[model samples]
Every structure is written in C-alpha cells, then in structure tokens.
Target chain A: MVEQHIASAFDRDLEAIQAQIMKMGGLVEAAIMDAARALETRDEELAQQVRQGDKAIDGLEELINEEAARVIAIRAPAAVDLRLVLSVMKISGNLERIGDYAKNIAKRTAVLAQGPNVSESAAAMRRMAREVELMLKDALDSYIQRDVELAQDVIARDRDVDQMYNALFREFLTFMMEDPRNITPCMHLHFIAKNVERMGDHVTSIAEQVVYLVTGDKPEDDRQKADTTSSVPQEV
Target chain B: MVEQHIASAFDRDLEAIQAQIMKMGGLVEAAIMDAARALETRDEELAQQVRQGDKAIDGLEELINEEAARVIAIRAPAAVDLRLVLSVMKISGNLERIGDYAKNIAKRTAVLAQGPNVSESAAAMRRMAREVELMLKDALDSYIQRDVELAQDVIARDRDVDQMYNALFREFLTFMMEDPRNITPCMHLHFIAKNVERMGDHVTSIAEQVVYLVTGDKPEDDRQKADTTSSVPQEV
Candidate 1:
C-alpha cells in the first residue's frame, strides 16, 4: 500500500513538472514570435516586453528543476521513471536556452530599431522565427503525447531553419559590400538571425530529448546541419 | 555489512565520474588553446585537429552523464551527494558547450586561413581565448577542491572576457568600414571572437555550479555583463 502511494505521488509530481514544461514552452514560443515581430515592426515596446518576459521563463525553469530534484530525492524513482525525470531536467534546460536566444534577439532588435532600416531582412527573420516557434510547439506536443514521429519531424525541420539563416547571412554580406552604411545594421541583423537559428537548434534538442524519453535510446547524431556560412568561400 | 559495501560502491562510482570530468576538462582546455593557436598562426592542420578532437570531449560527456544516471539509480544518493551528481551533469554540459565553441573557432579559423590575413585580430583573439582557458582551469580546480573563493574569482574574471569582446567588436566594425575587402574576414573573425566570449560565459557557468555545489545555493544573478555590442549605438 505504501509503495502504491509513493508511485501515485511520483506520477502526480511528474504530471505537475510536465505541466510546467508546457507553460514554459508556451512562454518561449511567444518570446520567439514577439521578438521577431518587434524586429519586423520596429516596435521597441514589444521588444522590451519580450526581454522582460524571459525572466518568467527563466524562473519557470528554476522551479521545474527544483521540483524535479525534490521528486527524485523523495521518491527514489527507478528505471523508466528515473529516465523521465532526467529528460525533464534536460528539456527545461533546453527551453531556458531557447528563451535566452529570444532575449538576445529582442536586445538586438532594440539596437537595430535605432539604425536605418535594413530592407526585407526583418520579415525574413520573422518567417524563420515562425518556423522555429511552430517546431517548438510540435516538440512540446510530442513530449506530452510521447509521439516519436512528431519529434523526428521537428528534428528534420531544423535544417530548414539553418538554410534560412545561411541565406540571411549571405544577404547581409551582400548588403554590407554594396553599402558601407548598411554594415552596422546588417551585422546586428545577422546576429539576430543567428540567434533565431540557435533557437531552432535548441528546439531540435528538446525534440531529441522526447525521442530519448520514448525509446530509451538517443537518436543517431547524424542530422546533416545546413548552416554553411562558416565554411562558405568569400565571394568578394 | 551489506549497506557498507553499497556505500563504498557508490563512492567508487562517484570517484570514477569525477575522474571523467577532469579528463573532459583537460581536453576542452587543450581544444581552446589549440583552436586559438591555429587562428593566430593560420594553421589549418592544427585547427582541423581541434575540430576532430571535440568528438572525444563529447564522448566523455556522454559517458559521464550515463555514469551519473547509473549512480543516481543504483546508489540513490541523498542531499549533498545528490547535489554532487546533479552538479556533475551541469558541469559536463557546460564543458560540452565550451568544447563546441572551440570547434566553432577552429572551423572559422580554417576558413580564415584561406583568406588574405586580417592584421592583429587573430592575435587579439588568441589573447581572449587564453584568458577563458585560464579561467576554465581555475574553475575546474575550484570544483575539485570545493574552493568557493576560486570559483568566485572565476566568476569575477568573466567580465574581463566580455570587455575584451566588446573591444574586438568595435575593432571589427572599424575594419569592415575601412575596406570592403576586409568585410568577409572581419565578419568571420567577429564570430570567432564572439565564440570565445561565449566560452567565457560557459566557464562562468561552470564556476557558478561550483559555487552552488559548495554552498547549496546559487550565487545572485546580478553579475553585470560587459558585452555591449548588441546594444551599442551605430557609429557609422
């Protein structure tokens, strides 16, 4: 009877932590979209909100971690239950990192708002951020549903985000080459683009965690990265 | 007698994991220095070595994490011991990230080696990387010794790394603005500098974990960041 009682308590604790994960995921997704939108619209107010909102996301991660530690300590969960706890900790860590990237995007957006408009890059960035946000939503859904296929799909989509970032990187370079005045703004935009790309990577990591949680095995680390800007030959 | 045996086994497991952490730390330190040296000397072969060597560092992290999970499951350490296990996981994560940054620096160095040399930036980057390497060494030492003072010192030194990054960012902007030919290389160099700056941040995180591991509380999150490139006003 006592074993059953403890098991139920663990279940309840796991559910609570999962709920917090979803809430944190929701906040991170909003941060991604709002930061991109702020850049697109040049709205410092919206950007500021995104920046401030990250604190809540960060706090949620801390809460989730503390709760996870408490559960592990008190319950002494074994095998699959233990794996679930570890995965939750990792997922929250990934979420926190994604939130940080969003904050970074907002910070850069505030700076870029003061500079001359770089044409079309902000909109491109919004589209990229949108894709990542959708991926994150699906990644969280996969976690909740324990759907391996959905998690795999999210992992596959990160390549597209990388490709988008590479395109922006090259475009920014061309703009800078064409106009010296464009250099500063383009550099900032490039970082914002890079930040969004990293968001996609972190979301991919969350999806990978889902896969690990379901299968008790990590997926092969053979996902082909599409970000080639670092290796691209200078055309200038 | 059986309980004592299990306790000794747990101690052995913990010791084995700590050994791995130290080994991982050593590889990461070498990676940082090798990547920086490659950049400073334009040594493509040395950079390639650093890139390939990261696999070992990554493999060790995976091993450490597996061992940690095993220890947690079999030993079910309580309180302080549990915190030690958790801190090991976090420290390995930080070390893994720092290794990735070193690989990134190497990747960029390989590309920059093929281009017309940008003057002085590579050497400056080497200096910045050297600082991070030293900080990481001290951070790990602090962890092993449970020396909170050394960890705190490592935390305080991260601001210096950030200030160095800010200086490099402005210098890169100046280089890019002065000549279109310098734009591509400077951008690559800028990213290498940013990667090193981020390495400092990860080292600080490792140090912070040391603090938490020793004190059972996180240090206040009030450490001021000195990297202002993202928010700096456009001077061009």
Candidate 2:
C-alpha cells in the first residue's frame, strides 16, 4: 500500500509537469498567432502582448527544469520517465526559441506597419500565416497527446510552408525591385515569411520530440529523406 | 585510496573525451577553411573533400555520444563532471552542425564553379568568407582552451560577419534584378553567405557551451549581451 501511494505521487508530479508544459505551449501558440495578427492588422498593442509573453515562457522553462531535477533527485525515474523528462527539456528549448522568433517578427512587423500596404503580396502572406498558425496548433496538440501520426502529418505539411515562403519571397523581391521605396517594408515582410518558415521548423522540432518520446531513435535522419524524396504539393 | 583511484580514472576519461573533441574540432576547422578556399578558387575537388569530411564528423558525434552515455551509466558522475559531459553532448551537436554547414557551402560553391565569378559583389563575399573562417577558428580555440575572453571575441566578431552578409545580400539582389542570367548563381552565392553566417552561429553555440562548462550557470544570456554591448557596433 505504501509503495502504491509513492508511485501515485510520482505520477501526479509527472502529470503536473506535463500540464505546465501544455500551459506554456498554449501561451506560445497564442503569441505566434497574435504576432502574425499584429503584422496583418498593424496592431502594435498585440505585438506588445507577444513580447510580454516571452518572459512567461522563460519562467515556465525554469520551472520545468527545476521540477524535472527534483523528480530525478527524489524518484529516480526509470527509462520511460527519464526519456519523458529529457524530451521535455529539449522541446522546451525549441519552444522558447519559437517564442523568440515570434518576438522578432513582431518587432519587424511594427516597423512595417508604418508603411502603406498597397502591394498585392500582403494577401498571399496572410494566407501563408494562417496555414502556419494551424500547423503550430496541430503540432502542439500532437505533442500533448503523443500522437506520432499527427506529428508525421505536421512534418509532411512543412514542405507546403516552405514552398509558400519561397513564392512569397520571389514576389516580394519583384515588389522591391519595382521601387526602392518598397525596400524597407518588403524586407520586413520577407522576415515575417522567414519567421513563419522558422516557426514551422520549431513545430517540426516538437513533432520530432514527440517521436522521440514514443521511440528512442532520433528523427534527424528520417527528416532528410522526407525533405529530399517527398512530392508534397504547395498549400498557399 | 579507493576514492583516489576512482577520481583518477574519472579525470582520465574526461581528458580522453576532451582530446576527442579537440580532434573533431581540428577536422571541422580544416573543413571550414577548405570550403572557403574552394569557394575563392572555384575548386570543385576541394569542395568534394570538404563534403567527404562530413561523414567523419558524423562518426565523431556518434562516438562522443556513446562515450558520454557509457560514462554516465558506469561512473554515475555528479556535479561538475556531469555538467561537462552534458555540455560536450550539446556542443558536439553544434560542431557537427557546423560541419554540415561547411558541406552546404561547398555544395553551393561547387555549383558556382561552372560559371564566371559574380562580378559585382565577389570581393565583399570573399571578405565575408575570410572573416567567418577566422571566427570559426577562434571559437574552436576558445572551446578547447576554455578562454572566456577569446569566446567573447568570437561573439563580437559575428556582428562583422552579419554586416558583410547583409551588404553582399543587397548587392547580389541588385545583380539578380539587373540580369536574369545572374539569378541562379547569385542565389547560390546568397546561400553560401547564409551558410557562413550560420557557421558563425554554431561557433557561438560552442562558446556558450564552453562558458557553461566553466561557470556552471547558463551563460547564454550574458554572452549575448556582452557580445552586442561591449565591442560590436550597433547597426540599423
């Protein structure tokens, strides 16, 4: 009976730690959306919100690290638990980096907002952002539920994001070449596309982390094959 | 006496691991230099040589990872020893990624060899490549020697690499716009510049790992501030 209680207590702590990760994920997901939305609507206030959330993400990372250390110190978790904590640590770093990228996008977006949005490319950019936002959401869901198939689907979708970003980049280049006046805002838009592409990468990182959580193999090798061999169509 | 023997063995293993890291660092440093030289001279065979070294880098990373795991399982080291192993595991990944970037630059450089040198921005690009190569060498030295000042210097120098890349990028964009024939090679050159920039980033990552090895506290944030605030000029 005592052993059962101890096991149950350990389970509870693991669940709590997982819950904290989910909370941070939720906040970061929102930050990505809000950051992009700020860019689209020129809402500096929303960009401010995204910047403010960065510290919370940092605090959540600290909490997760400390709690994982305590669990390892106290419970001496075995293989599966050990893998889970390790995945959480690695995935949390990716998430924090995604947050930083979101902040970077917002800062540049704010500067871009000062200009006229007369170009036709902004509409295509909005569509690209929406798709990236959905991918981020689904990737986080897959992580929380440990859904390998969903994670794979997220990986498959990254090609679409990459293609869209490339097209948008080409179009932006054309716009910039037409007039030097378009250079500054066009560069901001270019970075926004790059950030969204990078955000997709972070989601892919999360997907890979989920795979590692399920299986011990690193996903790095598999990704190269998918990148080189897959024939997925562009979405945006 | 028993404690003395175990401590001595532990120290020996650490020295062995450090030696291996240094060995791997030498190869990566050489690959960086050769890749840049190949680009400067358009030497396809030398580029291929850099590409071949990537496999050796992979082997080294695998060896280091296995050694780290074995040490953890057998000796169950604690405190500073554990931190050193952890830092090595992380930094080994950084070094391997740097190797991959060198391979990438070589691949792009190889393609550019078939064509005439980009007439407009080749000088700026050559300068950028040299600066990046030196930064990689200095960063590796910092890691092997645990020279904090040297690491700081590497970080500060990254700003120069970035500035050069930015200038090259703008110049290349103009070339691409002026002549559609230049687009393919210019894009390849752009990727080469980006690869070198990324190499500088990996060096900084290694520097961070070294700082963590020496100080125990995560020095990433402080290093970022010092690199930007101390010596590097701020640019708009």
Candidate 3:
C-alpha cells in the first residue's frame, strides 16, 4: 500500500514538472517571435519587454530543477521514471539556453535600432525566427504527447533554419563590401541571424531529448549542419 | 555487511566517474591551447587535429553521463552524494560545449590561414584563449579539491576575458573601417575572440557548479558581464 502511494505521488510530481516545462516553452517561443518582431518593426519597447521576460523563463528553469532534485531525493524513482526526471532536467536547460539566445537577439536589436536599416535583413530574420518558434512549439508538443515522429520532424526542420542563416550571412557580407557605412549594422544583423540559428540547434536538442525519453536510446548524431559560412573560402 | 558492500561499490562508481571527468577536462584544455596555436601559427594540420580530437572529448562526456545515470539508479544516492552525481552531469555538459567552441575556433583558423593576416589579432586571441585555459584548469582543480575559494577566484577572472573581448571588438571595427579588405578577415577573427570569451563564461559556470556542489546553495547570479560590444553605441 505504501509503494502504491509513493508511486501515485511520483506521478503527480512528474505531471507538475511537465506542466512547468510547457509554460517555460511557451515563454521561450514568445521571446523568439517578439524579439524578431521588434527588430523588424524597430520597436525598442517590444525588444525591452523580451529582454525582461527572460528572467521569468530563467526562474522557471531553476524551479523545475529544484523540483526534479526533490523528487529524486524523496521518491528514489527507478528505471523509466528516473529517465523521465533526467530528461526533464535537460529539456529545461535547453529551454533556458533558447531564452538566452532570444535575449541576445533583443540586445543586438536595441543596438541596431540606433543605426541605419540594413535592407530587408530584419524581415528575413523574422522569417527565420518564425520557423524556429514553430519548431519549438512542435518540440514541446512532442514532449507532452510522447510523439517520436513529431520530434523527428522538428529535428529535420533545423536544416532550413541553418540555410536561412547562411543566406543572411552572405547578404550581409555583400552589403558591407558595397558600403563602409553598412558594415556596423550588417554585422549586428549577422549576429542576430546567427543567434536565431543557434536557437534552432537548441530546439533540435530538445527534440532529441524527447526521442531519448521515448526510446531509452539517444538518437544518432547524424544531423548534418547546413551552416557553411565558417568553411567557405573568403572570396568576398 | 551487505549494506557496507553496496556502499563501497557506490564509492567505486563515483571515483570512476570523477576520473573520466578529469580526463575530459585535460582533453578540453589541450583543445583550447591547440586551437589557439593553430590560429596564431597558421597551422592547418594542428587545427584539423583539434577538430578531430573533439570527438574523444564528446565520447567521454557521453560515457560520464551514462555512468552517472547508472550510479543514480543502482546506488540511489541521496542528499550530498546525489548532488555530486547531478553536478557531474552538468559539468560534463559544460566541458562538451567548451570543446565545441574550440572546434569552432579551429574551423575559422583553417579559413583564415588562407587570407592575408589581420595585424596582431591572432596573437591577441591566443592571449585571450590562454586566460580561459588557465581559468578552466583552476575550475577543474577546484572541482576535485572541493575548494570553494579557488572556484570563486576562477569566477572572478572571467571578467578579464570579457574586457579583452571588448577591446578586440573595437579593434576589429577600426580595421574594417580603415580598409574594406580587412572586413572578412576581421569578422572571422572577431568571432574567434567571441568564442574564447564564451569559453570563459562556460568555465565560470563549471566553477559555479563547484561552489554549489561543495556548499548546498547556488551562488548569487550577480556576476557582472564586461562584454560591452553588444550594447555599445554604433559610432564605429
């Protein structure tokens, strides 16, 4: 009877932690979209809000971790239950990192708001961030539903984000080569794009965690990176 | 008698995991130094070695995590022992990330080796990398010794790394403004500097984990960031 009671309590604890994960995921997705929108509209106020909102996301991660540790200490969960707790810790860490990238993008957006607009780059970055936000939404859904196929789909979509970042990178280089005045703004835009690309990578990591949670095995590390700016010869 | 045997087994498991952590730390330290030397000396072969060597570091992290999970499951360590296991998982994650940064520096080094030299930037980056390497060594030492003072010292030194990054950012901007030819090379060098700066951040995180492991509380998040490039006015 006591064993059954402890198991029920563990189930309740797991459910509560999962709920927190979803809430944190929701905040990160909003941060991504709002930061991108701020850059697109040059809305410094929106950018400031995104920056401030990250504190809540960070706090949620800490709360989730503490809760996970308490459950582990008190319940002594075994096998699959233990794996679930560990995966929750990792997913929250990924979410916190994604929030940080959003904060970085907002910081750069504030700086770029003072400079001249780099043509169409902000719009391009918004599209990229939009894709990442969708991936994160699906990634979270997969975790809640324990749907491996949906998580795999999210992993596959990160390549598109990388490709978008590479395009922005080359475009920024061309702009800088054309005009010295464009250099500073384009550099800032380039980093914002890079930050968004990293967001996709972290989203992919969350999806991978979902796969591990379901299968009890890590997915193969065969995801080919599509960001080639680091490798291409400096012909520009 | 049986309980004592299990306790000794758990101790053995913990010792093996810590040994792996030390080995991983050594590899990461070598990677940082090798990647920096490759950039400073324009040695493509050395850079390639650092890139390939990261696989070993990554493999060790995976191994450490598996062992940690096993220990947690079989031993079901509670309280302080459980915290030690959890901290090992997080520290390995940080070390894996630092290795990735070193690989990134090497990738950029291979590209920059083909281009005309940006004056003194590579050497300056080497100096920055050296500081992070030293900080990491101290961080790992503190982890093994459970020395909170040394960990705190490592945390404090990250500020120097950030200040170095800011100086490099401004210098890169000046070079780009002076000659368009310096734009591409300076951008690559700038990223290498930023990567090293991020390495410092990760080392600080490892040190923070050390503090947490020894003391049952998280250190205050009051560490001020000295990297002002993202926020500074775009006058350059």
* Candidate topping DockQ: 1
TM-score of 3: 0.97
Predictions in order: chain A TM-score: 0.97, 0.87, 0.98
What DockQ does candidate 3 have relative to the true complex?
Answer: 0.69
Give lDDT: candidate 3, residue A211: 91
Pick out the ten consecutive residues of candidate 3 chain B with the lowest summed lDDT: B214-223
Which scores better on DockQ, 1 or 2? 1
Score residue A230 of candidate 3 by CA lDDT.
90
lDDT of 2: 0.72
lDDT to native, each model? 0.92, 0.72, 0.92
Candidate 3 off by > 4 Å: B1-8
Report the C-alpha lDDT of model 2 over A1-236, residue by residue, as the tens digit. 98888778878888888888888888788887888788778898888788777888888987886676566556655567656765676677777878888887777666666667747665676777677778777877888888988988988898888888877777765665566555446655765777778788888888888877877767875254222101111111
Q: How many residue pairs clash in each candidate?
A: 0, 0, 0
For residues B1-236, could you state the per-residue lDDT of candidate 1 as single tens digits? 99899889988998899999999999999999999999999899999999899889989999998899888888888888888899999999999999999999899888888888878988888999999999999999999999999999999999999999999999999998899999999989999999999999999999999889888887776578889888888655
How do the residues B24-53 of candidate 2 rate in per-residue lDDT, one tens digit apiece?
Answer: 888888888888888888899999999888
Best by TM-score: 1
Pairs with backbone N, CA or C atoms under 3 Å apart (clashes), candidate 1: none
